[model samples]
Target: YKASIPKNGGPQIPDELEDPKAFKLKMETAIQATLKSEKAKGETYSQDEKELMIWYNYHFLGRGKPTTHIQVLSSVNNEQIKKNLPPVFKEIFARISSKLKHQS
Candidate 1:
């Protein structure tokens, strides 16, 4: 899995996760937990895909945000890894998209 520093202040997972799949799962769980906890704290839940996309952009790209097309391309560079990433990212994206589809 590709590794990069997130732009926002938050906890960072360690780099020695060994298995990328497991690491991705952990990240997904952490994101959901953070969002859910935020919502529980009386934050208005914004169900906008664009906003989630931007969150992911900030977390991954760490620079001026890129378009969805560019982000997708960059996230999946190797053909083999690309095929695998869609399924993994899709699940995470689905959860995020469901929460933030309006921003799309």
Candidate 2:
């Protein structure tokens, strides 16, 4: 199974996450290399960030369902992800949260 992040409210498969374990391993490599990759860039990941990364990898990359995505998104403690991720990602999350809230 594979999970992905959406580039335009649609699925985007990251080449690095082709192998979940490999991606996880790559995440721990030297900061310089991570900085060179657009996926990681120069930012240092906190525990929350790491968890989100793993979860997303498993969810989108590993074929986790949309309902699961909704549940996870609803449960997320967004302060950290909101602060760390790009504005577009934050907006996307907000939109998903809003849509899910309205659905319930």
Best by lDDT: 2
Every candidate's lDDT: 0.50, 0.54
RMSD in angstroms, candidate 1?
A: 13.7
Candidate 1 lDDT, 8-65, residue by residue in tens: 5434443434676764544455445445443332235444442343355344444444
Q: Relative to the unseen true structure, what is the C-alpha lDDT of residue 29 in candidate 2, on a scale of 0 to 100?
A: 39
lDDT of 2 by residue, 1-104 (tens): 12233445432324464777665554543232424454564356775565455445445544556866675566656685566588888789899999999999
- Count of clashing residue pairs in every prediction: 5, 7
Q: How far in Å is the alpha carbon of 1 misplaced in model 1?
A: 7.5
Q: What lDDT would candidate 2 get against the real structure?
A: 0.54
RMSD of each: 13.7, 13.0
